[model samples]
Target chain A: METLFSEMQGALVVMPSGRLDTNTAPEAEKMLVDRIKGGMNQVVIDFTKTDYISSAGLRVILKAAKLLKGSSGKIALCNANAQIFEVLELSGFLTLLTHSDNLETALGIVGNPA
Target chain B: MTFRTILNAAFPPFSEARRTKPREMLFSVAEKPGIGTTFTVSLQHTLIVLTMVVYTVIIGKEIGLTDAALRGFVALEIVVMGLTTLLQSLPTRFGSGHLIVHTPSVISMAAFIAVANSFGIGAAAGGILLSGVVVIFFSGLLPRFRSLFPVEVIGILLVLLGLTLVEGGVQRFTGLHEGSFDTPTLLTASVTLGVIIAFSVWSPGRLRVFAVLAGVIAGMIVAYLSGLFGASQMAVVSSEPAFAFPLGNYQIPAPTLIIAAALPQLLIEVISAVDSIGTAVTIDKIDDARWTRPDMQMVGRTITAHGAGLVLNGLTGTPPLGTSSANLGLVAVTGVASRIVGTATGIMLVVLAFLPQVSAFITTIPRPVIGALIVYTAGYLMVVGMELILSRLLNSRRQFMVGLGITVGVSLMVMPELATGVPGHLKPILGSALIMGVVTAAVLNQIFRIGISQTARIELSGYSAAHDAAEFLEDRGAAWGARRDVISRAGITVGEVLEVLHNEHMVEGTVNLQATFDEYRLMLLLDYRGKAFKFAGDQTLDLAAFLEGDEDEDDLALDAAMSQMSGALIQNLADKVSSSSQKERAGLRMEFSH
Candidate 1:
C-alpha cells in the first residue's frame, strides 16, 4: 500500500508497509524511480511491515534491480515477513533481488557488498 | 393497437400471428442466465500476462544491461508496470458495467534507452511523466480513435508482436547457447512442466492458483537438491518504501529533451490502449453478441489512469512495466472475467512487498525453468495470434496482407537486430525497435495502399464479416435490451404509483379494489416499453397515453382493494420481475387468491 524511499548513507533504502497489493505496487515502483533519479544507485527495499507481493510487484522490482546492475549498483531487501518471502521465492525474485536480516545489515551489505 | 393488445398478441393463442423482433448486443456472460464465474475469466487474463511477461523477460535479458541503458530501461519498465496495474484496476473499479482490457505497451519500451541515452536520464524520466499526462489529457479522444484504427489492424499488430517474440519461446526448449543446458536443468524444467500440465488438466479449484507457480517451486526444489544453488546465489531487493513525487532532481535536464521523449511515449501509450481494447473486443465477441462492451474511450480512461500511476513509478524506486500479455493468455483459457483474481494477485504482490527474501527466492527460479514458462506463454501467443488471423482477420484479399504481413513483419524484426549504421534522419526514432516496427508497418502498408484501395470492400473480408456479425448482434439483442430496460423502468414507475394507490383509503370508507386494479392495469400497459410498440409495427411501443390518464380518488374499487390488500392478504402478489425488461414488467403477477 505504501513504498517509502530514503538515502541511508550512500545507499537508497526503501521501506514498504501496509498491503502493497496490486493497487499499491505503483507506489513501490514510483519509489524506485525517485531513488534512481535522485542519483542513489545502491538501494534497499525493506518489507518488514509489508504483507504480500504479486507478479506485478515483482516485475517492477526486477526491472529496477536490473537497471541498478548497470550502474554497478546493488539492491538489497530487508525485514520481509514469511508470506512475502514465500511469494518472492515462488515468482523467482529470490534470484534477482538480495535480502538482509535487518535494516543495518541491509545498509551495510548494499553499501559494502562482499 | 395499444400496449395491452401487443402484450396479448405476443403471448396470444387467440390473436394474430407475428414474428418476434431481435434484441441488440450482448456479452457472452450476459447472454447466459446465471451468475458469472470469476476464476475462469481471471485465469484468461492471467494467461495473457503470463505469456507476455515470459517473453518480455527474455527480451529484457536479450537487451542485456549497460549503465546508461539500464537506467532508462529500468525506468521504462517501472513506468509500464506501475501504469498497467492502475490502468487495469481503473475500469474494473469504475466501469465494471462494460468490458475493458488492459495489457502491455511495447512501443515506448524499445525506445527507452535511445531517448534517454541520447538526451539524459532526467530527460527520459520527465518524458515518461509527460507521456502519462498526454494520455490522461487525451483519454477522452481514444475511443473515438477506434474508428481510425480498426480492431483488425490491432489484432494484426499483436500477431506481429507475438511472432516476433516466438524466438524467445523456442529458446525455452533449447538452451540459449552452447553451455546453457544440462541434465539437472532439463529434468527440473520437465518435472515443473509436468506438474503444471497435470495440475492444469487433473486438478481443479485453487490448485489452479499455483500451477505455474508450483512448477517454479518444483523446479527450484530440484535445483537446490542438485546443488545448483547455494548461499552465494542469494539475491537482495531494495526495501525502501516509495515516498517521493515524480519531480525533483529527476526533473527534465532540458525542456526540449522532455518534449522529444513525449512524442514516442504518446504513440506507445495510445498503441497500448488500442491494443488492449482490441483484444477485449475480440474475446468478448466470441461469446455474446448482445452485450455492450467498453470501447476505446474506456481504454483511454484506463491508460490515463495508468499514466497517473507512472508518476508514482518516478516517485518510487521500481522500474515501470505495462500490462503483461500473460493476462491475455489467461483470458484465452478461462473466458471469464474474475477481476477478483486480479485483486488476489494484488494481494500477493503486497505480500512480496514485505518479504524480499521470498521474492528473491522467486527470482532464483532457474533460468531454464523460467524459460519453460516463457515457452508456454509464447507458444500460446502464437496460437492465439493464429486464432485471430483464422477467426477474424482471415479473408481472400486482405488475408495475404494480414497474414503474410504479420509473419514477415514480425519475423523481420525478430530475425536479428541488424545494428546497421544509424541513419541521420532516424536518429531520434530508431532507438526503439517497436517504434521502428510501427513506422515500417505504416510505411509498407501505405505503399501497399497505393496499389490497394484504402477502403476497399474486400480488404479484409473475414474481418468485415465478423464486424457484420457483431453489428447484427447489436441490432437484435442490444437493441432489445435497451428497448426493454427503458420500458421496464417506465413501467416500474407507474407500477409503483398504482401499488401506492391500491393501498390508499378513499372517502373514509371501503376501499375501491376494482378502481385500483384498473388503474394499475392501465398504468402497466401504457408505461411499459414493450407496450409502446403494441400497434402494427413489431418494435413500436405506445405506452404513454394510458398511464397519463388521471384516476379519481372517488373510485370505490380502488379504496376496497386498498382495505383488503393487507400485508397478510397478498404476499403472493409481490414483485417477481428479475430482469429489467418490458416483458418482465408485463409478467408481474398481482393475483387474487382464495
Candidate 2:
C-alpha cells in the first residue's frame, strides 16, 4: 500500500507498489486525485510493482480520469502486470485510457498528449 | 452527601476492564533443543510410544500372522512411525512442528483384524491401502467440507473412542469370558496400573515421563514370575535373529481381501483424518507459545501424511499410523516440546524396526500390561474428549447430537450380542460402537448445522492487505449467489476502504469480516481492532475553481480533496454504508443491493 509520487515533464508519476485492490485503492486514489486537484493534469500510473488490481482500483482511476477529462488533462498507465492489464482490458478501461510498456514511453505519452 | 457517595459521583461509571497482552511460553515453536537433551527426551518418548509395537503383537497374533510376518510388520511399523513423526514434529512443509509421535492407530488395527478375520490378510491389506488413498484425496477437499465434521462431532467421536478403548481393555483384563474376571489377569493389570500411578506420582523429573514404560516393565517382571512368560516364549525370543531385513521375505496380502475390507477400512481411515487433526490441535495447545487455532494447512498436511503413512503400512502389511495423543501429554509433562526430540524418536524407531530381537522382547510384555496401558491412555482420551465437548457452549441441538452419538455408540460397543443376529458383512460397520457413534454424530451435526451454515467468519492477520480482503468478498459473494456486477462493486468498495486504512498506517491489527447474503442485498460486516475509519467525502474537480486558486490555495484544496476522495468510490458503488467506533475498535457495515 505504498505509493511513490514524483513529477517528471510536468506530469505526476504515481507508482503504487503492492496490491491496488479495496485495501489500497483509497490511498492511491487520494494521492493521484489530489495531484490532479492541485492543478497537475497529466499523470503516469506505474504499475510495475503492483501485482494485482481489482475493480475497486479501476474505479479510482476511472474517477480520476473523468475529473482529468473535464480539464483537458490526461493519464497513462505503464508497466502493468498481466493481471492488471487483463482487468483494465476486461473493463474496457483500455479503450478510454492510454497505456505504455515502460516509464519512458509513459512519460512521452503523457508529456505530449495526442 | 456522604464522602463515599460524593467520591462515587465524581468518578461515575468506573469499570474494571483490563486489556490482556499476548502470552509468552517457556519454549517457543522456533526454539531448538540441545543435542544431549534431544537424545534423552527422545529416549523417554520412544519408551512410552513403544506400546504401539505391543499392540501390533496383540492384533497380529489374533489375525494369526506368522512370527516373521509379525516381526516384519512391527519393524516396518516402527520405521514408518518414525518417518511420519519426523514429518509431523519437524517444522517442515508437511510437519505440524510439534512434539507429536506418529504410531500405528488402534482404529486401523481393529479394522485390519476384523477384515482379516472375515476376508483374509489380502483383503485387509487392500482395504487399508485403498482407504489410505481415499484419506489422502479427501484431505485436499476437507476445507470445503469442514462443516460436516465440526468440533462437536469430532469431540463425540473421541469420547466414544476412549470409552471403547477402555471397554476393550476391560475385556482383555477379564480374559476370554465376557462376564467373569480372571484373577491372574486382574492381578497383573493391577500391578501394572499401580506401578504407573506410583511413578507418575513419585518418579523424579524426567523419570516421571517414562512412568508408563516403567509400569510395563514392572508388569512384565510380575507376569514372568507368575508363569505367564514361560520357557516356550523364551525359546521364541532366543530363536529371533538379532538382525534381519525387516521385510525381506514379507508376504503381501491378497488384493481380493482388500475389496472385502474396503468399507470398514474406509470408515476407519475417515475417522483417522479426524483423529489426526484433533491430535494436532491438542499438541499445538500443548506447545502453547507458537499456537494458533490448528493451522488448517498443517492439519491438512498431517492428515495427508497419516494417509500416506497408512498406505506405506498397507504395503508393509502393518497397521495405519496416527498422531499419538498420549505422547502429547508426555511432551507436556516432560516439558520437552521440541521437534528435535520428535525427529530423534522417529530415527530411533526406524532403527528399532531392523532389530527383530527388540521387537520380540516388546512382545514378551504380558497382555494385561498392554491392557493396563490402553486403559490409562483411554482414560486420558475420554477426559480430553469430554473437555473438548464442554469447552463450547452446548445448546439443545448440540445436546441432541452428542446424546444420540453416545447412546448409540455406547450401546453397540457394550452389547456385542446385537451384531450376532446381523449379517457378517455388516458386522465390521455396525458391530463397532465407535464407527456407529461417529456416523450418528456426523449425521446429526450436519442436520442441525444446516440451520446456521450460511455465514462464515474470516479472520485476517496483520499481513493480509487489501487484495486479500477484496478476494475474500469476491469469493464469498460469488458463493452466496450475488450477481457478478454486485460482487464486483462490493469487492472494489471494500478494497478501497482497506487501502485508506493501510495508508494511514493503521494496519497493525487483526481484521475480521463476516458476509451474509439474502435475496435483496449482500452485506459485509467488517470488524477490526484498530483506529476508526471514515469514508472520504466527495470532492468533484472544478477547472474554473482550480484555475483561480492561489498557490497556497492549491495545497489546502488538495487536503480537502484527500478527505473527500476516501469514500467517493464506495459511495457511488454501494447502496448504503455505515461505520462506528468504540474505544480502539471499529466496525463497518456495507450493503450492496441488486
Query: TM-scores of all models?
Result: 0.48, 0.58
Q: Candidate 1 on B179-225: residue-level lDDT in tens? A: 66567667766776777676666766445544665666686787788
Measured by TM-score, the strongest candidate is: 2
What digit string (tens of lDDT, one per residue) describes model 2 on residues B394-502? 5577778889999999999768898888666566577878778878988987777565545767876654655566677656653443354566666666766676666
Query: What is the alpha-carbon lDDT for the whole of candidate 2?
Result: 0.70
In angstroms, the error of model 2 at B527 is 14
lDDT of 2 at B85: 80
List the candidate 2 regions with Cα displacement exceeding 4 Å: A1-114, B1-31, B35-37, B58-64, B110-123, B171-188, B198-207, B220-233, B253-264, B289-292, B453-594
Share of the reference A-B contacts seen in candidate 1 = 0.00
Q: Residue B404 error for model 2, in Å? A: 1.3
- How good is the docking of model 1, by CAPRI class? incorrect
List model 2 lDDT by residue over A9-112, tens digit each: 88898888877765677788887778899899988899988866755566567667767777888789999876567556544567667788989998888788
Worst lDDT window (10 residues) for model 2 chain B?
A: B13-22
